[model samples]
Target: MTFYTYGYLTTHHNTWQYARIGLLIALLVVFIGLFVHYLRNRWNVKYKDLSIITGVLLLLVLGLQINSLVSLQSATKQSGEISATVQQAAKHLKVSPSSLSINSTSVSDNLLIKSSQGYYRLDYNTDGSAFILEKVTLENPKIKLVKE
Candidate 1:
């Protein structure tokens, strides 16, 4: 899946971020409480089992936090790359990037930009390190590309 889709899956907005962190903290508190109770009732078999379960849960929460951090980093990087590419393409077309609307599919590496001048599609390389103009459909016949 693309970074955009993955990010959406994990978090939709700032509120979700706060909510997720809050939930994680609550889980940590619960685990700590369970562990302390287990220690106070060390002789009970049930407390021993509960303590082990709490330990496992703590590990799971730690893993989830790590994964969330990685995902956020990746999403930020991918967003920057996409913005840069769009700006470069807009410059080439002699238009403001803000004037163009982007349309991308989750399964496709290509991105489509629609502007008043025409429709342009950009296709990325297999490794996604670079992209090139794949196609253009101009709205005006008077507009022409100058050969350099």
Candidate 2:
């Protein structure tokens, strides 16, 4: 898996970064609590047992932290894809994304569609006046702009 660092917090929209940081803080608290408890009840448990317990707990927390990071990455990728699709649609329509209303059932012959749940298969005519939206699962969908 490729890993890229999103500087500070903006790259992740402060979502994943906050979660991962929270987990790290939790892990630190757990470790400190265990150490303090051991100090206060020195006669209750053996050193070897305490060591093993601490090791196991640390491993569990580390696993959870890793899972949280992975989930954040997946969410970020999905959002990025949506943003790219919106940009592509704007380019084809020659209008801002805010001005376009897209529906699955809406057929088009001139628009380049980028769908979150569909593959990228774009078709453009030689004259650049018309095109068909072809998806792997969806049948031939076409779009034509209404000229003023």
Candidate 3:
């Protein structure tokens, strides 16, 4: 992962998630501390039972958080791959990203990039699990603006 990917993950990519994670962490600490205080001040069977319940809840929340992180990581990885591919294509063609354009909507996830130098095709699986760049020839490429 590049620094750009990390930046997007922290800043641009579903910013609400990071905030939610932070809030959950704070609540977890506060509630756990409260439970510990109760247990320390007075020994009770009910408090111990509730503490066990809290432990189970903690595990569940952690599992869910891991699931959320996995989804976020996958989405970010895909976006990063696309961005890197476009940037690489631009560099290979000796042009800046602003001078480059790509079209992918009709290509089933693969990209057809256009630049003044030539054409470059970024081929990848439809599932976005992989991508590769290749020099291509297109007579009349109807590429729209997608210079990531």
lDDT of each: 0.62, 0.51, 0.61
Point out the higher-scoring one by TM-score: 1 or 3: 1
TM-scores of the models, in the given order? Answer: 0.59, 0.44, 0.53
Give the poorly placed runs of model 2, Cα more than 4 Å off: 1-24, 37-41, 46-55, 99-148
Q: State the lDDT of candidate 3 residue by residue for 44-116, as single tens digits.
A: 6666666667667777777777888998887777665556665666676676765655553123454566667
Looking at candidate 1, what is the lDDT of residue 81?
A: 60
Tell me the RMSD of model 2 versus the true structure: 11.2
| Residue 25 shift from truth in candidate 2, angstroms | 1.8
lDDT, residue 60, candidate 1: 83
- Which regions of candidate 3 are displaced past 4 Å? 1-11, 43-54, 98-109, 114-148
A best-first ranking of the candidates according to their TM-score comes to: 1, 3, 2
TM-score of 2: 0.44
Q: Could you give candidate 2's per-residue lDDT for residues 1-148 as a string of tens digits? A: 1111112111336455676677667766766776777788888676447656766777776787788778767766754544454456557646554443333222234323433444334565776444454655546745442211
Error of 1 at 129 (Å): 8.0
Report the lDDT of model 3 for residue 27: 55
lDDT score at residue 134, model 2, on the 0-100 scale = 63
